[model samples]
Target: MKRQQLALFIGLSLSALSATTLSTTALASQASDPQTVFSQAYQSYLAAVKADENVQQTAKLAYTSGKAVYGKSDDNTANLAINYAKAIKGYGDELNEQRFALYNEAHTILAANHGKQSIETIDALLGQANYTTSAYKAANFLEQVIDIAKTQNKPKFVADMKLEAASLLAKKFSSKKYREAKNYLEEADEYYQENLPENSLERIKADFLMASFAEGRKKYNQAIERLNRIVNVFDSNLNFDHSAELSAHSKLIGLYEKQGKSEEATKHCLAIAKMVPWKESQEQTPLYRVNPDYPLNKAKQGRSGSVAMEFEVDTAGFVKNVSILNSDGGVSFEKSAIKAVEQWRYAPKFEKGQPVSATSQVRLDFKINR
Candidate 1:
């Protein structure tokens, strides 16, 4: 097992002891047949998921499986479904120990029997990938799917697999398996190049994923390059929507701003607001704001000390209220600190890249000794 897998396994086994409580709350107040009720709930969940593109399809699928089991009226199957959902929802008190472990074992057996080349095996593996909290399992199973997609020479399937794998990578970027993720993404990129033509949606998607990985690594300039390519490609095609172009523009502006390239940043910011009506809030306007900074204050002299200050900025950029969120036996010195911060300079807050008056929270640390 890899380092990430080891971390995931250890994370799964802990010293926490607790009892399982099944939620019959929805069932207890039942006013209809269990099968009908479950079917309706399952359908509602699917619609709720489909209506929102951001909804994780995996959650909905799990619900559908539960509904099927419940509709059969088998006590054990119904119990398994409820427990699986509880584990998924992080409902610690409602977890079913036997069912949860059994679900895992069932998935493993299914995958082992069908082999990775079978679509049935892929579906079972993907289901397990979706329901678990283990990042390692998610990444591992997704990799397996990608492997099958590649060997199968299915363009659309390959694209879908890569995108899903990239998304998981973005979530687990901080883990030790990032290198493996990069390798998979590179493989995906090659597939896109061979299978997806210029200006194809899949190519654009591939570009976006590579750019996101660059951003995660703090390679701002590289990220900018990938995003620029995406924009240029779409622009030349004249078939893509302005919204996609605007997204790339926003990303570039943010990258430039983070790089402290004020001139480049301003240029992109203006372009974004003009190109997209919703981005006007990013413009610079006069707003009372304070940039908080702190220095190590381990050693100092005198009766002065440092403390945390919380203040609210008004819509007009004025410091309206100041209070200590935390104090180290030194509330007396806070008044002076707040007074000084009130006069601080700030660029105006913008909503959607357009200049807009807004309330922003700021934190200040006064180090009396430093």
Candidate 2:
């Protein structure tokens, strides 16, 4: 199996275990020593995790004690701020200004203490990347890390940074951005071939990004070739990421559909049905949606309404038996919703490693252009 790699994202989460921790108890007794208090706080946090209890209290204690012990402007203090931020972020306060400030604090301290080019600044820059929603900005942070890794003669780190930089830049399409990202990816590919194993997930992820780049540029043939390679790899190496394989099939469907190749698209549609569905997050959700059309009569009358329908996605991943449970609109709206849903597709549920039909409920809304 390919070694698990860090998540390739702007907010590449720093490991919370970076700081030392061990047996410690009674925070009140360790109040005199901020370091001891910090350790105690982490110990309490571990118990909370094991017991599946809320971690806010212990997390706050760790933050408070960490501040006291890491008052100096140095790498240790920078890392402390990052860990504290990660703790609260786990509670779902991802967009809070305070969290971003904590990340910025780490970046500032790291730059001041170790200089901009030091390897130590990498985490802080990556931490700051989480504070921004812009893919371009996140790629910029990776670019800085690229320079730092080069300065420190860390080829592996540089390659890792480039891989992520390419992924982020692939989020949008622009001729200039594509060219720049391609360069980063090409070099990273070279490093991966020489260093990482043949089946490295990171290398596969890099290929995925390159495929996305091709898709963005409307280079459909190139994108299909790359995605097919990923699918083939997973076929031989069952340990590979199945989601990426499903995603490859999904991408192939879109690419083929754009070229009016229904047979090719259905091949993927059937492929998805044979595989288990991904539901842990929307990131892995496949889109074969066929939107309901607005009725012309409703549009001319400036009427808007919704239709609630229940349907089954058969083992073949085709929508069937779309029954309207309710509707605020007229029969026209109901008919449109049914027609559209019948064309929709899904990754049918699997049981005992076998494809199974599944039912779904949906509310399709239709609004006239205002």
Give all candidates' CA lDDT scores: 0.53, 0.69
- Steric clash pairs (candidate 2): none
Q: Please provide, for model 1 over 149-254, each residue's C-alpha lDDT reduced to its tens digit, 9 standing for 90 to 100.
A: 7787777677667666665565544375677667767776787788777676666766777888899889988899989888788668776666767678667766
Provide the RMSD of all predictions against the true structure, rounded to 1 decimal.
11.7, 7.0
lDDT of 2 by residue, 1-370 (tens): 1211111112432222123333322333344566667667766765764564665566557556766765656554566566566656343344455666777887888789767788767766765655555657766787887888788677877887887666556554344477767888889978987888756776677767778878878999988888888788788898755777888889888787677675677767777767755453432233476787888898999999999988887776677888989999799999998998777666666666666777777888998666
**lDDT, candidate 1, at 246:** 66
Candidate with the greatest TM-score versus the true structure? 2
* TM-score of each prediction: 0.54, 0.75
Global local distance difference test of model 1 = 0.53
How displaced is residue 364 in candidate 1, in Å? Answer: 5.6
